[model samples]
Target chain A: MIFIKILSILVMLFYALGSAGVFWGIPAERYKILVLGKFFTWTGFALHTLLIISIILLNGADDLSRGYFMQLLAWCILLAYFIGWRLLKSGFLSLTASPLALLLFILALKVDKVQIEMPGTLKELFIALHIGPMYTSLGLLTLAFGAALLFLHMDRKIKSKTRLTEFDRGLPALGTYDRINHLAVVFGFPLYTLGIAAGFIWAPLTWGREGGILGSWDPKEIFSVFVWFLYASTFYLRILRGWRGRKAALLILFIFGISAFSLLGVNLFMPTHHSFGSLATFTA
Target chain B: MNKHICLVGLNHRTAGVEIREAFALADAGLLENGLLPVGAHLKKDLPIKEALVLSTCNRVEILLAGREEKLEELAIRSWAAARNRQPEELAPFVYVHNDAEAVKHLFAVASSLDSMVLGEPQILGQIKDAYKDALRAGSTRFILNALLHRAFFVAKRVRSETGVASSAVSVSYAAVELAKRIFGDMPSCKAMLIGAGEMAELAATHLMNAGIKSILVANRTHERALELASRYHGLAVPFADLFAQLPEVDIVISSTGAPEAVIRAKDMAGVMRRRRNRPMFFIDIAVPRDVDPDVNTLDNIYLYDIDDLKEVVEENLTQRREEAVKALAIVEEETLNFCKWLESTELQPTIVDLIRRSEAIVREEWTRTSKRLRLSEKDTRALELMLGAIVKKINHDPINFLKNRFEEEKDGQYAGLLRLVFNLDKKELCPRRTREHGSEEAPPPLGPPDGGMIPPRRTPEPAAAFFNRIKEGSK
Candidate 1:
């Protein structure tokens, strides 16, 4: 436990340092600092991976906590960023990914470590499928949100014909941001739908007929359905309707906000079957 | 004999364009033939060992490594004679930098810090081409080869470590930069030239060089449009088809002599709808403004008139000037490093002589003493080994002391003193003579100067002051 605590702190420190390096490097136009930032990020990621493996080994899959899931989500976000970075060849994504990951990791540390129980092996697999795909989709959406923000900023700058700041100069082209947004939405929406469908299937089997697909009208379930609809519409508009640029970017940002609230806020604050402690007690 | 590195040249600051044009070596078929017209003259008439002639529109510099005596006067006279001019006429316009100053000048030139448009990138490529020409002509040997390679390294260092050359300094380049900001991949983007104007043509050329897929030309005169279109291998469309072509291209450059705006906001709105709101860049270089200022109000439309591009150019030029200061510092640091290497080359003969003389004395003493004792073969071998170790031990301190002195003494005073103290320079005791026996030994081969690669002997105060004096005098 103490080792886990120390490892988490180290992960946070490296992430904080990496984000600081990236932020400082962009405006200062220093390549060495950017390289140092990348080194720190990779080191932190390696340590974070070790921490995740250790947590699963110690607690076992059946007794995982909400805090552990939060850490997993942060890891997934960083994973998404690395994949995007490789495909797009844009360092600008780190400008958003680094800070967002650091923030999420810190938030994960603050969350209470109350382990939830799962009854059987098949149910545990179902839960993993439900949560894993959902978290990964959210992670990609978070990046899409970041790309949208940059797109709007660059769009306004070009439209206004304003002199670009040093930070602005380091940003990728507006088209690059648009492409990232398009790719994120196209991939994210399908995984999100898969996650929701998996939850619908798992809830009936675990809670019986009393907890239907809607999970007895739980706020988490209602919000998940709402976010899925929003995501699907965005996906449809982007692919079939050829929606692009500012309007599409704005819609992606809106969907990401609601999805984040549904995933985290409803589970922690609202009374729902998806709340880890409540679900564990109800099962007992 | 010591070889002096010298640079004789005239730039925009020192001479008018007419004088620069007259002295341009590139025009005399130097680059094509890969021969310097003055190379043979300098090598035969003077003691020049290596020569490289760099001629660009803004400057022409002749870099030479040769005998220090009369180097400046003879190099200038030969360069003038090659151009069919008198030495007196060229002397007033030309400035000379020797030794360390020459290294600094070459580095500054390669880094584009000395360019007329500060931080322009063309100068480095021009230098590389000039070096290649000199190599093909067999004029650049040892000293010039090392120096040119060092200059290239310094240029690369400056470019990567500083923000110099990161921004556009001209109107057309600024337009292209803005287009790049809007559209990430230039090769996929198409451009349209709305009129056959000079500024529009320049912008089209810049876009083409940036790898835009294709260009469309529209002009009031169909022949003029065809002429411009054929030059770029683009299709020429009629003036009436301008609105039709607007929806096709991502970039539009307009400099037509129309009395009113050629592209209006409402028209752009329809075009944007047809283009599915894809981004469009309009560069208006016309006096009356070919693009409506209100066109900027439309979604996904970026419009920049002549004044806005001028502002961007002005801002970038200021940014480049600031970056040039950092670049100059890098050049100064690298220049000092190269000079240290040059000074070590001067210390090479003395260091070699010291080791060789010590070994000779040790061997002679061992041979004479062992003959009287009549030692066995094994004992003789052991004793010779001990004597060899003693010779190494004896030469250690002198070598270290000379190296230490070399770092402090820039004029080779300690090397000369070491020679005198050890009597290492006597004709009979000289290692070069004994090793070669009968054949005439060539001058020391100026190989790579990796040996004795120490920090510079003194601070850059004198070099900086000299640079400032040149800058002031040129003005």
Candidate 2:
């Protein structure tokens, strides 16, 4: 576990350096820095993988708590960046996603202060199915959010008539970034829908429908729906109303903010099965 | 004899177009005839070994490699005689580069670092063409072969590794680039050329290259429109059918030499209504302004005038200048590398002579041992192979050391000492045997050496304006 913690910190530092190096003025140094960053990141990823495998082997799936699941979210985000870096041929995507992954890894290290137990029935394949799609979609949406932020930054630079810096030049084409944003939304929204459906299906099985399958209108569940609607509206506005460019970037930015709030904030304040009993428990 | 490289040239900065044009060779015959007249005269009157003449619209340069110590006067005199002018008349405009400076100048020129429009890529192609002419005329050999090939490589490196040429500097290119931002990839969009003028044709060329699906040429003269349409592989619509084609095409590039507006705001409102409000890009490049400024106010209609494009061009030029700083660094790095290689070549004669002497001695020793041992033919062959391997391994370190370092005056003295100690004949040290023996070994191919110091290969796409790139990114 200490090894894993050390590796995660190293990953954070490397990712920071890599992101910074992409904007380096000298082309030669920029290449060297980018390569070094990748080397550290890959090494850290290996250590992280070993840590996860060891945890799973020692504790088994039942001991795979929300904290571990959050660590898995961090791993998934790194994996997505590696995949995106290959497919898009842009280092900027990795630069954008790395900090988010670092944040998740740090969160994973933090002690889970709140602990309320979930029903034993909730530990089935349905739970894994629900968590998998939810976290993966979250990772995908995070990528879209990263691209949207870059779009906004570049757009702002152009609008304000500020001279574009070397950092701005390193970003992918606005259209390419926008398409990446659209693609992440297109792929994530459906998976998120699946996760929500799986949550509803498991709700009845676990809770026995005594207080209603939705757990008596849980606040976390309501906010999750709110988060879903925000992202869903991005597609609706994009496909139907032809909202694109800056307008679409703005909408995705908002959706990402709300999704982050729903995922982290709701978990902290509201008691629900969606938190897997790791977050704060509210008493009426 | 030490062959010195020199460049005597005049560009837009050093000379006016009139002066440059007077010295420039405007015909392919001048190249094939074994000269630009100046090159031929230099070959005849001076100790010139090889020469290449790079003549573009903006400049005329005579790049020479030879034993001539006083090449500037010879080059200037020949240039003046060829142009039927006095040597003193052209002396003020001509500038000279010697040896390393000459190599640096060639690298800069080939990389477009020395171009009037800082990072335009056409200069590299022009350099390539000149090199090809020199090669065809049998005027480029040994030193030039290495230098010219390195120049092309440097150009390729500068282009791929820097953003120098990644922005449009011309108004026509800016218009097309802006159009791309409005309508992504414009390949499926129909574009109408509103006039058959030069600016319109240039814009149409840029648009066509950007992959517009179709083009419609419209002019007051039906015949002129037909001529322009055929040239661009587009349909020529009659002037009367302007409104009919206007509603169909998504992009309108109007450069008609009109005194008044060719497209009014009222006309665009109806066109927008008829087309169901699909986005339209109007590039008004005409001076008196072919499209009314008010059309820009209409919903779904984006109108950019000549001045707007000029502003884009200016911004792009600014960006290109920023990129050129990186590009010139690449050029300087490549220039140093080429100079190192040239310096290494100074050690080549000694290296070649040393290897030959070693090979002869090894053969003699092998024969003596074989005869004494009375070894079988197969055993003797094995021994010969082993000895050959030993010789290669022995030479590898010295060869690599000399090739990698920029050999200085001390290194040259070391080379001379080695030759003298080995009792090597100066005749055996003559590396230019191809010239002496009249052997026709082809010059090195005009590109980067295989597996050299260049970074990994990247597919070089045509340079696009940075504004369009950002605009598309914002999308």
Candidate 3:
């Protein structure tokens, strides 16, 4: 079992190395090499998800929110990465995703901060409400936030009227970057809504049937709704007045920051019902 | 005296831009003015088969492929007439090389070795345009076509394999880059070329290429200013109008040989007031300087003198002749290989004619023998077929052998030994296109070597020679 884990880790590392070579090395248009590298990365992701599913099934998914959170979130990001790369025709997708995935994979292997305790009858329901949507929301926010940063940098450079380097002229136009950021926010909004709804649904069943456990005052609940509203309004205003520029973009940038804190930042260094008891995770 | 090649060339490295333009084939049809005399002379003596003239700012060259001794003189007159001078006047300044030297000259010109700016790619493009004109005149053929294709490839190789074109730290390049950093691109801005010096001419050249519009050149010498402005089709103004025009032109480049500052802060104060909030690029390349240092005190005016421009030129990350070394190495390697192949091709037709003639005599003898003996139809057909197969089989080996060796060896006499070995030489004896020396033994590889290490196969037959190569590859 230990040996299998080591082999899997090595395969993931090879995928990252190959991805770096194609992205930043000799830069040949290697069709076969590209397909093969993507295959290894996806296969590693699949194995990682499978191992988490098996562990949850054996040990039970009662209070396993953090354990499942990191595992499922890494899986979701990889999922979105593959889909976005295919649909968007973006070349650097693998290059960016490789570093992010490698970090998450290392974190999953070593971080032992998750424990799940649940009643037998509500175990299946609890897992869905607690673990699934939160990870999905975090994945969506990660992509949206990355796109926003790229948009801001490109906008600043273009407006300054600086000389375009040989390579700078080759990048996609500022408007294209801005549009992609808007699209990422539009895509992420529903995932955030689903995560907030799941949190509310699981709160009553786990802590108490009183809706008092997950109230509007809870920082997680309040921030989640605020984020949903911010993105939703931005989406409508963009279509109504064609308001998509630096002003609208800066607003989107703030929303992403809020979304990140609500997902993982709030859980850390804070006392809240969101921080249920399962912290210590599996041993190697 | 046949149509080989006649080169009368002048380029940037050989003459100044003024001299180049003086002799430049400016009129569209000056080629006829140049090549017609060569053509008329070709009619009298070894004739000019075809002619083409390529004239650009960097080089003016006439490529004549004809069969004539006096054709070079005729080409010289053609150039003189274009320059409005006598042949005697133009003769001293020109180089007239023929045959392989002329062939090599045209190749080098097309490859841009003859360019004013060594290894400039514009000459290669100009050469292609020259070839296009030659096509319309119906003078382009196998020899010229092969030469041009090989020349273009050689240019590509020279660029890739050498650094001869790498270190072009020109003033215009520096100006373009600095302007870009300030304004991103100059397409929107108005460009001003102040003074008619060489630096001004170069800066204007760069600006025009960079797509800067509304150009105006101000100089104390109005005619010199006008002459420089006319080249790029720009406007000219008197030196007194420098301040008045500075407000209209966004970019100002001053390159006069002035001893002191020409445009002072007090002078630009009135012009800057009317300009409102526009950005100005001041490139001062004058030796003693042109724009006053105090002018930079005003907002939105970027100033750079010759020293500053030189600093920028020094800092260019790209080396101009970086590719030239690698490109020239490739050019030399490829040229050697190509010339070798060309020499081998000259021997092929003569060898083929010898064999075909041999085969004909055999056929004629077989028919005559069959007719005299009154042989049966079946016997006659079988005999004819059998004899034909023997002849073909005998000739096939040497033909394939000689053709393969052609690529490796340039000299034909080495490979033409097949003609002697086959004994297809006597006319009456062979009864076909035959050589006189049918009975002589096959020729040696190195012209009867001075008793050097004898050919490994100082043996009986070529089959032994075939085994030697197979054994060598195995080893």
Output the number of the DockQ-best candidate: 1
B1-475 in candidate 2: lDDT tens per residue? 2557889999999999888877776463444554343333234533666678888999888888765576777767867777778989999998899988899899989989889898988898899999888877767667787899999888888888887887778988877766665555577789998886778789888888888999999989989989888988999998988997788998898888889998899888777666755668888888899999888766556788877777778887888888888888887787788777676666666677678888888988887777779888898788889999988888787666655542444234445435444645433332456544432443222122222232111111111222244468899
Fnat for candidate 2 (0 to 1) = 0.03
TM-score of chain A of each: 0.86, 0.79, 0.69
- lDDT-based ranking, best first? 1, 2, 3
Interface RMSD, candidates in the order listed? 1.4, 4.9, 9.8
lDDT of 1 by residue, A1-284 (tens): 89998999999999999899889987687768987887788789889999999998987866766577678877888898888777666666787788877877886776546555453548656656777778778878988887888889889988877778766887788898888888888888888888788777766666564745674887887888898889889988878767788888999989988977876677668887757446441110
Please provide, for model 2 over A1-284, each residue's C-alpha lDDT reduced to its tens digit, 9 standing for 90 to 100: 66545655665566555445544512444656766656656565666777678777766665455566666777887787777677556666666565666666666656323343344564556656677788778777777776777666755554333445555555565565577677877888888888887777766665666666555787777877887788788777766665555777788888878877776666655676555354422110
> Which scores better on DockQ, 1 or 2?
1
Tens-digit lDDT string for candidate 3 (B1-475): 1225566677666767776777777464654433454332233322554567787877777767654465677777767776677878666556776756666666666666655455666778888888787666555544466667788877776665444543335767777756764555467778888776777778778888888876887778899778877887888888887777877888888877788998887887677657743557788888788889787665456677787666555533243344444554565566566555555545545456556776788978876777789888898888888987888887787777777775575444334345445544432233322233332443333122211222111112332343454579799
Each predicted complex: what DockQ?
Answer: 0.63, 0.11, 0.09
For model 1 chain B, where is the 10-residue window of minimal lDDT? B454-463
For candidate 1, the chain B TM-score comes to: 0.76
- 10 residues in a row with least lDDT, candidate 1 chain A: A275-284
True-structure RMSD for candidate 1? 8.2
Q: In candidate 1, how many Å is residue A165 off?
A: 3.3
Winner by TM-score: 1
